[model samples]
Target: MSASKMKILISGAGIAGPCLAYWLARTHLNAAVTVMERSPTPRVTGQSIDIRGPAIEIMKRMNLEEAVRSRNTTEEGTIILNASGKPFAHFEGGDKGGDTFTAEYEILRADLVGLFLDATESLSNVKYLYGDSIKSLDQTEKTVKVTFAGGSSDTFDLVVAADGGISKTRDMILDEHITKNCYNFLGQYIAFFSIPSRPTDPKMWQWYNRPNGLCVMLRPHRNPATVGAYLCITTPARGQQDPAVEAALDEGVEAQKRILHEYLGNLGWETKRVLEGMDSAEDFYMSRAAQVKLPKWTNGRALVLGDAAHATFGVGTTLAIESAYILAGELSKIQSSEDIPRALERFEEVYRPLYTKSEGLPPFFPQFTFPQTSWVLWIRDSLLWFISKTKLYKLLPADEGSGLELPSYGWVDIHRKDE
Candidate 1:
């Protein structure tokens, strides 16, 4: 039960899991952390994400700021385009660091994951298992016994599910009722992929909204040869699940692509080119926008963090980084493995409020943002043009900090030169 001898297993080698491992391995606890990812190799495909508020501080603490900045997507700004592919409104990028649609620290999700993995590579006690997952878990008061999909078994002092919002590992440990009640769907389905870039591609992020609740976004990437593309469709009502979307989610990639094509193929302004790129894209990801609202983050020796615990849209990456740091910090305060439950409780108590503050979307939100009629779209466009012309967006407050006073855990410095 000693701190040095403590063993922790983390599910999902995405942003949160590897980040948690990085901290746990470097903390005073010196816990041996094992990260299990279901994918055969590290996932190198995902939409772009940003780091804001306290997460930027945490990145500095982990000595990853320079490395992260080097991989920036280099998007100059955001441009809202009309159906004719002409810009009607423009918001400059966050180069000077005020609130803007494009953040200063914008990086692809895969690049961030790679950075975290590279950061933890030299840590002797941290291990990564690819093509493996937790088939089942048995938790007692002191430890958790895990059965892996690869037919291996191990006992760990603690188990953390940093998998994702739709975490299979979380389902294994939490009750069905608790799991069911935690989901708050925003009734929006999104598909992300990479499209071959052309000379005409704009350096700024181009957002095109069409009638019938359809939208297409194309953002510049660090690699000019390709661009990140997003296709979105909003349901009629909030919290309503579309049967077709559910079926597409249940089925494989082809079905998901079909659903997107059925909804957005006819819409012009790069729709045809985007769909063509999607057809050849090796990294097409689709998911519904849902928030996971868990009453408690820990159940016995098992705990969930990041999207597995609190998944929201706007500040997901920031929350993931902040939660991992807080969880590791809490564990560092404990003297023995027996104190883990208390530590886990403290982690939620301190972190949950910060998460809830960023949880909900504004009233109508994405629904209202995507107009369904021509008149409504005209109004939206006119309003955006007015706002842009007047520079009204500057009145919005900047994301200064997380408001939660971050605790000093006296973590050991694990700085390494980027390879």
Candidate 2:
């Protein structure tokens, strides 16, 4: 097998898949890259996420920084409020130790994904097959045969599962026990939806914490008439036995409305207001927070990267994009298909440690994020106040991309739409 004849199939065109496709083609790796997406089109719904660290460097290298920066949420700052909607502490969204509230680059997940799509739409070597997914994968010593949900089959030299934390392809390669162990659900549930904003709603992130382990947040979007609502609450073990949201999550917006109404209908501080149009909101998403801890990232011809292999807490996008960059760079160096396995190993060895370290949670992280008692709220708010007042937040680095050096991979002219 030669470099020009290599075929790579990637699942999930959300972020990592598209970014991987761009880099793979941009590096002139000579491999045909095809992204199979389960959805018909690019998802236009998701809360904002930061593109910090080395991931930002990749975007700049691709000449996508200005496009991404143009879509910044422009969030002013965060206001942590009490149960009664009274402000307890307000801080500018700047670097404050590891507790940095905002990064230099912040874009809504949908917008960022769109940026990737636009960036790669013109690349002749990259292909996208939407509205379909890999149903089963049967691999041999030389090639892997993939059967799609639409009853199509294809063979590829390598398959990358960027499908996400709950990867179905990972299950096809590994067992149920291994999958369970790899995913450590933080026993918490968060739901996001958009509600019509009030004229008085300020263009800032507003958070309200109650004495019942409930944290509600409102982030003003670029659309002034609508605001993004986020609700976080501690759930039971693993969130597998979710009698509350299991059917709701499967059913539709109406089911979500009924479940959320039963749990958060009576809360204060715009909680009820946000849930008013829940039945009509199409972007309602609720799921358990999880961290992926795979024993190994690759098995035979299949490789799992990004959220599928890492993604602890809520910050996994940047790491995912970075993983794509490294993996593509590694593959670009290979002259023959025989070296793919070793390249995959190098990708895991170089990134597994950094991603693993980032999965560590602070002491009583859930309690600090959403306190259930008055004392906890007081203590948490007081600590935030002290951190802000004393300027101790400056001790921490701004973004994790500090020392990461990006490889050029001889990718000088990779179809970048001019500056």
Identify the candidate with maximal lDDT: 1
Pairs with steric clashes in candidate 1 = none
User: CA lDDT of 19 in candidate 2?
Assistant: 91
How close to the true structure is residue 277 of candidate 2, measured as C-alpha lDDT? 57
Give candidate 2's error at residue 192 in angstroms.
1.0
Per-candidate TM equals 0.94, 0.92
Where model 2 places Cα greater than 4 Å from the true spot, the runs are: 1-4, 95-99, 175-178, 236-242, 400-403, 415-419
Tens-digit lDDT track for model 2 on 18-121? 99988888665667889888889877888878887777777888788888878877776777787688876666664443436766677789989998898887
Error of 2 at 58 (Å): 1.5
* Deviation in Å, model 2, residue 367 alpha carbon: 3.2
* Residue 10, candidate 1: alpha-carbon lDDT: 93
> Model 1 shows how many backbone clashes?
0
